[model samples]
Target: MKIASKLYRTGAFLAILLSSAGFTSCEKSLEEEAKTFINPDDFFTNETQCIQAVNGVYQTLYSIYSSPDYWRMVDLGTDVAYSIDVNSAVQNYEFGSGSNGTGSLWLNAYSGIKNANLVISRVAVAEIDNTIKQRILSEAKFLRALYYFNLSNTFGGVPLWTQEIDINAVSSLSRSSLADVRAQIIQDLTEAEMGLPLSYPSSDIGRVTKGAAQALLAKVYLFGKDWKNAKATALKVVNSGSYSLMTNYDQLFDVNTGFKNNKESIFEVQYLREPTSNTNTRTHSQISYYIPQRDAGKRTYAGVDFGNLVVDGWSVFLPTAKLVSMFEPGDKRKDIVLGFGFRDQKFTRFPKPGYPWFGSKFWDLNANGQSSGKNLYLLRYADVLLMLSEAENELGNTAESIRWMNMIRVRAGLPELAASTTRAEITNKIFNERAIEFVGEFQRRFDLNRWGKLIEAAKSVAVDNPVGAAKVKPFHQYYPIAQEEIIKNPNLEQNEGY
Candidate 1:
């Protein structure tokens, strides 16, 4: 009944949004039927409709990444983050096909992939401007690659779908090998780079760009252990002259500063609460989940009450003691990353040891005290620098790696590394730097797994928390394919140790 395009909903294409108000337009474009849906024959008649179609792909990211279960899947069971909730706490080390988060992530990714595939397969021949058509197709390709990248990283090898599939007609589907998936992801991103623009106007700010494609490609290479390409691609973004570290580290995550598409961000999912819609939805619950629980009556932290810092929160996602101590001396990032303790980075300290240390990077108070319109960064300039540092070190370019590492170090108020640093030493330093830099961004588990250090890292700190110990296992490296998906497609097999 309603057409919800991802780009159209972010206030980028208000014209398209208004046109979707009528049923005829909705029926002609992206309509989902019970068994067989309408083909793209009538949908790709114009550029506006094509844009509306692509927006549906973007909408899938919100349900995937913004869910509470998604964060729990990545951070809760790791050394840096702990979950107070029982179900979430169990995910730190153990996850199965039944995991709600796994199902949501898989379903959301494929849903996005389906939409992306539709756009890529049909929008090119539309009677739209050649440039606009290519850009739309490029964005669709980038998004499809993103879904596959996440799939491969999480499930090792997932069923690769490049073209739209008819659910009723396709009775069975098989998973692709991880190698094939990685190759396809790389191919998609490389092809996407050509059509993507270097930048966009303020209204079109959230659209994928050349830098975003490169950044994602670099990450894919990093995950695949392609050090040469990883360093090269990451360096491309660093030297592109399009991005820079925010002068103030704290402002990088501050929602109030109007820093949504700042120079540091390569790509981010844009969310809006105003101009709100019911069927075509917009909003996220991250703020309410991340806000620390505190009492206004008792001065527990910073000689102040917790309610003073946030309206209220789920009180989950507490930081581990190991994470608190990992920060280097004189590092400003430590204070910026954690809250509910002797906090000096962005807020007052908690003098009393009453409240758990919660992630403060996404701390934005909303009017309803629930969802906040804070945009989450999928790729940032800081991450590019760190990736380059890691990639160069892996390539045996120790001096070159330190050069990049020092850039992030200097920004966090830490001393620069010596050029004589060893590969082992620089790798550890880079790992620690990323942990501090990207806290509360849900990056730790992936980094550890990619580096082959997840099991060991979990083992080393398992003694600290029995709950964490219960969750950590070698089989936990990749999550199982959701049971629902397996049932829908018998070709789907569960991951090992599930």
Candidate 2:
């Protein structure tokens, strides 16, 4: 009950960055006041406040992922998801340094990192029990590492800050090398894995755990092309006995199925449909952008009254036909993942004209368009298994790789591949499997970039939406630094091409 009381107020910490009060060097009175103000140092004196402080960092995640513009930055214009709106800057890849989508994501990520740094730096001497202190510190590290991981992937070696920055020193900071960023991320996650517990009580289900840190470390390794470390860390999670695949694939994202924080979830951004107060970020969550516009009780379509799963959505990101064809003939995941061409025509009443393939992963019958409480999974057990397979094959362990890959395939109701399969074949199979399994989950663009296939994939899917693809060049592997940010900090440089 107390956690609920404090959790809703956690989002108030965002005011540290969002406040409109200008910081000016000429205002000596204000600068002196800022120095004496009771900040995280004075605020986190007790356990309850420490819990609230960490909750603030978690609150930043809602703003990071829930924005429709965020989805446009990551998923839209990719091979798996497309939008027809040529005027949409992000979808069409015509956005320049002034793009708000890129700027918001950049600022939101740093805001989270800044809050986590406050916790990590202040909680050390907070007069709490050693166990509780370690837990809080580990959680902070896990979150900070996550923010940096996303930053490095998106903008490539963004400014790295492990401690709070004074307003006067903000513009002096410059970008760190990618290698340096990766080193810090690995160090933070390694410490997190050591300090985090394997599991928590039901009340603390969404908190980061030992498995989550290890799973994310494995992903970081995979991104850096360190196959040996990637496999080692991934297998650590697989053999840890902490997670298992849910029996039914569809239940993973089905809000009606009561599987929001199931065994498969390693890390998730927790959201609730109903908030305890007006300030709570729980009610701020939104996944409606994935739904079809007129379908699901929004209006009559194809002369049929399709019932609402969630109403009045924009259907901005529709599934691509190429993604629909990637699934094998007998894979059950296809039916659950894509609602486009099903025999019952569940996703859309008319698939011929719009060819809408809306995501069925996050549906709740009781939801209004914006208040859906579906948790956005950051890491899952299935992703771990697939990554393990990928790392194993890269290290010449084709047999072991197939064994790991088969676990996922068997659960998907498809026949397993042969153990005698070559390394290249198994690697490609795992790649394609990830493409289909995690299509609507915001992993496509990053996956393609890490695999060094972004340019090729964009070209291949050019015909799907020519106007958008024509603007996607090889330089687009990294988004340009926002003009606002560059103007604020002269040290910040734009990526190669605007």
Candidate 3:
């Protein structure tokens, strides 16, 4: 799950605002060039234009994650993974009094939310074809809900803005009650599910689908501890037949394969290597940053050579020893999940001595020494399965719980967990599995917090790492709301103990 951070700079938000305003005019001009330009009020006169507008919404979604603060902060803040020295400031918890707090995950998520709001507000009033208009609005709603889901999870109750709010008119906004925020999220997702199609054509694979909406709704319900609703929505996705678990677990993240379009993927941040069309290319795909070999010649696009891995400076993400130990011995997923090694112990098979980073499997080390970029998978079928098992166990459905848990374990080449397993036992197993499965995919902190184990976990592990010992406090569970935001919005009360 993504979190909010102070990292969103005012300049970046201003840039987006200017760009969106400019696009409105550019779009008008382009339409006129082809004798297709309609009046501002008349622009959404047809389905094609409305659909194009919806595509713009997705474009915004794609751009948000590419920001440095969002991915970096999320990867480092979590417990399942750690960043190496290369990107240590955030990973090492050494984030100082910078313009933004720590990294900028917080600001970027809100920026995405703001952009979604712009789309929803503008598109709703446009005179577009009804079906297309509704669909576009639904997509915007889904994206907005996703952004809020990340925010609510990270910061608890946050300022809930439905339509676009005028910054000048509203200098201060208070955090809404968590209940109210969750209600809005459910409402947005519910609308999205009704409007979205069960699936999309191959060309539209990365766009949000009905299954994606439902899966996300299930997650929202699960986090809110609405067990029945979570179970029901998850089952809807499963029974809809819109997705299936990939036959090979490893294939879900295989760079060579079109992992973004894989069967198991429900929602993914889409990035393309070479773009012939404007819609397909990405500027900040993960492969460019994570791939180790700087001089590897085979290039689909110009890859950034960060010069010899600046061990502490550039290679920021590293796997923690605790995470390494969590993997059961002989588990095939252990190697695939954490690259070739277990903790600091180097693997004789695949060794990189200087910087033993966490996410090696995500690299596309081809025989020709070329690599396809790394695309992050935010939601997948396996996650849903694990969630389903979690909800079932919480609801006291022992048989159903075992069935789901075993499904994932069986796929990972592990024996089925027995039905007699206690809820605590099953929960631990599921949590461990999630850690390994999602290791550097950026999901550790959320898992620990949701399990109510972050403080304890951090303290226990502090014996080896001093930062963990010193910084592990109850308040650390929720990231501090940026001080600037508080000054601007007096309604925003600081989280207790912050």
Candidate 4:
């Protein structure tokens, strides 16, 4: 069995080149593209080679942000309001056909997982120095864990492929229980924490670090409702003092300052737009895609019509009235966070002449063009603080929960909650704070789910017009397993309630 497994793994590793061809082509054009190649024996022969392979894995991370599959699946579940212009057939929200939004997410996520698995398996057999080998393996494992985390959350139990699997073995795969998937995620993250460095040099700034692993682990624990573990891990991240809330939250997303490595950011999928440099090129920015043409007048790359814009219809993801109303009257975060209306150093609705109703703080109008270099913050210190608060509250540590919540509130220029606050009050406070703090950041859905309020929130957000009533049910909370995956692997079962 072991020998057969090894042979199958080797064959699976070879298949990565073919699978990667479709995904990797969009990023860069390889000079030496080969047909039907199985070169793993030579792929990890040196430190430089190993580093390049690892970088390829990082490139795959970009797909999570740029791919329509990822954005649609994540955005649909969130409170961020969308128009029908985004109606690519891929995003139709169908369950059984395996060609819906959920199906796209499933395929894209596994594509990434397969890439990571190739890196991990190949690096394991390479006779490199132990330290270098360990770190490379750790990076791959961290990425694999991240992919599985998304899968487990969205699809519930999913086929868990650890090592590279042969094309022939693909049909034999079965959906692992959520518990099993979570165990693997924890195991991978624990290994990543031990192997990853506490920090990286300036050149290696975008790479995962010990803090990223710890932060992710904290989030995973929180998602699982393992409060004690979540609290312990989050507190470790906080007390380590490795990160802090950025004094100016605006700077956290600023692209012009080259602020990709800001102190507040724990992990950001780094993107650059200079076409000349492959190292700093990124084509996905929601700001550029969603802003209106009038607001983006004469800005060529600024407005994407997406064929959905009507005379009155907004072009892209617009802030919800509920979301806009959630902000405090004088809160500084209200303007920087939501950009609703013009106020006397306060919040207002969209009445400005040229500015679109849904203006973005992340982008600025430059004479040169509509430049969008904003770092999409995947994890931030403020999230850690909130997770800490949630875990503490769940664990019945009210004082500690209050402390962390207050820390975040004070940073956002809001008053701290009173000591007499009840647990429900604290929970509501955190939810509202998160909504405002992370508007249009693709986090609201996950937050609602973890709090057992996803169905209610989804139903509430559905509307006949862009702003009123649509139907949402509890079954919609978790995306159905893609039908294609089920047909390919008999062991795979559709998620319950799908």
What lDDT is reached at residue 103 by model 1?
46
Comparing 1 and 4 on TM-score, the stronger one: 1
Q: Which candidate gets the maximum lDDT versus the true structure?
A: 2
Q: List TM-scores for all candidates, in order.
A: 0.87, 0.90, 0.81, 0.83
- Greater-lDDT candidate between 2 and 4: 2
Worst 10 residues of 1 by lDDT: 14-23
Give candidate 1's total backbone clashes. 10
User: RMSD in angstroms, all models?
Assistant: 5.2, 3.6, 7.0, 7.4
Name the TM-score of candidate 3: 0.81
Task: Name the TM-score of candidate 1.
Answer: 0.87
Per-residue CA lDDT of model 3 for 108-169, tens digit only, reads 56766766776677778777676767777888899889878878777788888886765543
Residue 455's C-alpha lDDT in candidate 2?
70
Cα misplacement distance, residue 24 of candidate 3 (Å): 12
Give candidate 3 regions above 4 Å deviation: 1-42, 86-102, 275-280, 288-313, 341-356, 366-372
Which 10 consecutive positions of candidate 4 have the poorest summed lDDT?
1-10
**Taking the tens digit of each residue's C-alpha lDDT, what string does model 2 give over 1-498?**
233334556667535422322222335465455633344445778887777778778877777777666677777767787775657776677878877456478877887887787778778878988888899999999999998888888888888878665655756689999999999999999999998999887777788899999999999999999999999998899888999999978889877677777999998877666423323336433445555456443364333344544355555566776777688998888767765542364443533465555646644445664676567888999999999999888889889899999999999898899867999899789778998778766688899888888776666676666766677787788888888889989998788887
Report the lDDT tens digits of candidate 1 across residue range 342-458: 334333533124334565576764323465667788999999999999988988989889998999989989899987889999988977887778877768889999888887666
Ranking by TM-score: 2, 1, 4, 3
Which residue pairs clash in candidate 2? 296-308
What does candidate 4's lDDT look like per residue over 67-107, in tens digits?
54565566554555444454443223344445546535676
